[model samples]
Target chain A: MERLGSGGREGARRIGEVLTWDPLVRLTHWSVALLVLLNGAVLEDEGQPHVWVGYAVLGLVAARFLWGLVGPARARFTSFPPSLSAARLHVDEVMHGRERRHESHNPLGALMAYNLWATLLAICATGLMMESVAFFGVEWVEEAHEALFAWLMISVGLHVSGVILESFLSGRNLVRAMVGSFHKRSGGGA
Target chain B: MKLAPFALALAFAASPVIAQEVAQGDKIGTEIGAIASALSERGYEVRKTEREDGKVEVYAVREGRRFEIYVDPETGAVTRVKEKH
Candidate 1:
């Protein structure tokens, strides 16, 4: 997974020198972000555009699920399996000031990633239910969709905060890494 | 500095800015049962009635199609009927 970024020292270096997010990962990430923002803030909630955007988000998530299985080593779910113990250990290490820098996603980040994906799936499901004739005007389903959307927003805020915190701790520009092709190298263990 | 016209245009274009103010007087027929009965008279099986703004939104079904009827609570008049697809 560590080698998944650069391949070798002599590969492409468009923006910087490291590649943390692959094309599929970056595409899905930004697409989901834009679609969610459009649906939540810009478009009318019950409008056709909002429904289409929701479907697009669901499609992006579905594609990401497949990519997690057959994509690069860094993008795979196995690379950062959700583990409560691992997340606790990461938090403990952070508290003790002995946290090791992970080249891929850290434990807490992995959990957040899984949380966002699952929450998005739930939101999409509820949204679809609301569209169906059987579930039309179903108050609980609409409420569940609204609740999941709130959770997604909260997860996004936490994810960005964690990224900034990790960047400071590990001396890596994660935002830049996501934008371009390279993450600044920092000496730490996974 | 000189982009006031463009900015105003953009603001209106991006306006999520429709505001409707409903008068909240003593409603004559605002009860859920009353709304359900009113909808039942229209050949609808009333499932739920929710008070939204100054209107009662009745979710009802007739045959197979679902309908959302917005009714004036004071007048008991159906303001709008939206078929839920």
Candidate 2:
């Protein structure tokens, strides 16, 4: 039999590279996303599971916040600096149909990530406030929370669109990279 | 028996006040314990818990009333919490 382990006609080196996400980070990210979505969408029935899911989401966010301080290189916030000028330039490029390939999130995408997290934190805060007598049944607090939800939904839509656009533009399967933690070997452009 | 109605009526008459007292006490104690435990488990040091008869009654104190939890013991679910005030 031909050698099967790292020795074949195609050679030992794989075409693509893998930089798998830390298991905890990936678990927290996906689980938090699911919980937040469920809490926003399906938990309007005022059920026990809904409350529990909210608690779970809160816990996940807290953990992820801590992890961001001491996680993998790619997972760290320092890896993606928040630059308004950079973001504006990227937006201008996108509008002009001249976007660049990014192995990680582009400047615009990073801004979206920032918006998503900020809005999510606001949602959690307003949600907790709504539980109190002072804020409960208060129209403004409720409205604020609802408005944040709408904004978050829009941001999420745009984020997904950006992903699809980038995938095609970069000629790489971004979704697959997110799931499998593999990226096409680029010359460090993104 | 003949005395059963009298006793029942007496109990019914007094039951409201007694139930109110018991419910208020239970709400305070349980709310405090539950909130304290929950917070402590999540690394918060609870200071106290209290109950008052108002639009909102039950509350838990951690540092400075960190959580004002309204609970329905029947279902064991926190109806709400006043994390702000």
Candidate 3:
């Protein structure tokens, strides 16, 4: 967001690269992204690979949640507490062209991130249950797994769109920030 | 992104076809209860019996070992037994 002044984009006040997401954050983010895609679309659901991928996803998510509790200042859950009121205020601020800086995830992003994690965990739980003798070929268990997966797919679409929209509004490549240690030094909220 | 839902729909649509295809031996129907009893006689505690891919799959446990016992729907003959991990 540091480039907002030089870029001459009105209401875009942030500029230059600043350290945002930590290495673990970026690693888990992308890894989960790939694994979700593989398990959701690429791999055969009945195949062993899909089950393994689900386990990997659950482990990564658990690690990420732990990091949120005991990680760096910016990566902690306190930095981006999920709150509906704050998210609503953020929307109002955006609509009024009043850009604000957030040290971590913006309120809306925080809520979505939490949603993604919770939904992912539920998906894994259902998947694991299906492998047991009790739930094997159980109608409701299978139905729940598929339904949760569909919800995950929808959440992923919203996530990508939100990233693009936030990047455009802030005049910074959020993608670049998540990809590496540095982000453009600018006044923008992820 | 779009393909996920499409694929999911396709999966749901394809399952009923498998349910319709279980016609083994002489096309004489072997009821679910009959299959369960047949498997129970083999010391298998039957949990579920479902028609899949032209066979009646009986999910059972024998001596605490989980198994999938595939039976010919017509003759109720044990065709395959797979131990699940």
Candidate 4:
């Protein structure tokens, strides 16, 4: 087996450690991301293709919601339940420049992930409702859906910024780990 | 008498205008009602309908108004459905 860390150093114990995310978890994460982006950018157009894409996004969201409960370790909601106090403390750590690197999501990052999923669900529900005749042409429903899209974009931007900041702070390329399923550092903060 | 001539002219002039309005109203009402029923069969409730200049205006409530679906009166096809703001 490959040694978990470099040079058998103490700090190296957490460095160069590789913990793989299960295939289901990875698929759910990327599918949700792509669907959200598609719904926001391309589905608003007046065409049959747009409607089909909207339906596909709805299906993807439904699948991901179910997976959150039954999926593997890192993907399970139980694995990373949100805690307000923990998030606040994490925020403080960031401010004080003493935040610890996490193998998985940090408290603040967990909160963002939760919000992103919830917002996507809301958007999908509202979008589906709009297609029904009773709700069709209702101004408020349309407006609510659009508003959720705006919020989703903001949350995604914040999430990206957090990932970049963490990568620098921890001295590892977090984005690369997400793609390649391995990190240069041994610490498996995910 | 002078009054008889004026009354006759007035009735003639007003007849076409009144007939046109009624015809337009009937067409809009029938078309909108049919469309609303079709949508209702597909699970939608029509909330309001109006005949404006040359188009029929329809408003509907679906899923407790979480979203609104709009339809074109002329073709009785869906225009768009959007979430309520």
**Best candidate, TM-score:** 1
What local lDDT score does residue A134 receive in model 4, on the 0 to 100 scale?
54
Best by DockQ: 1
In model 3, what is the error at residue B60, expressed in angstroms? 3.3
| Top lDDT prediction, candidate number | 1
lDDT of 1: 0.76
Per-residue CA lDDT of candidate 3, range B1-85, in tens?
9999999999998775433322223232377887776556556677777788988887777666677777776675667777777
User: Model 2, residue A71: what's the lDDT?
Assistant: 64
Screening candidate 2 with a backbone cut-off below 3 angstroms (N, C-alpha, C), the clashing residue pairs are none
TM-scores for every candidate against the unseen true structure: 0.77, 0.57, 0.74, 0.61
Model 1 chain B poorest ten-residue lDDT run: B19-28
Each candidate's fnat, listed in order, reads 0.25, 0.00, 0.12, 0.38
For every model shown, the clashing-pair count is 3, 0, 19, 39
Off by over 4 Å in 1: A1-18, A181-190, B1-31, B41-43
Alpha-carbon runs more than 4 Å astray in model 2:
A1-20, A93-103, A181-190, B1-85
User: Candidate 3's chain A scores what TM-score?
Assistant: 0.85
Kindly list the per-residue Cα lDDT of model 2 for residues B1-85, writing each as its tens digit: 9999999999998764442211222333234466456445444344334444422334434443345456555444555655643
Clashing pairs in model 1? A18-A181, A18-A182, A19-A181
Every candidate's DockQ is 0.29, 0.05, 0.17, 0.19
Q: Look at candidate 3 and tell me the lDDT of residue B15.
A: 76
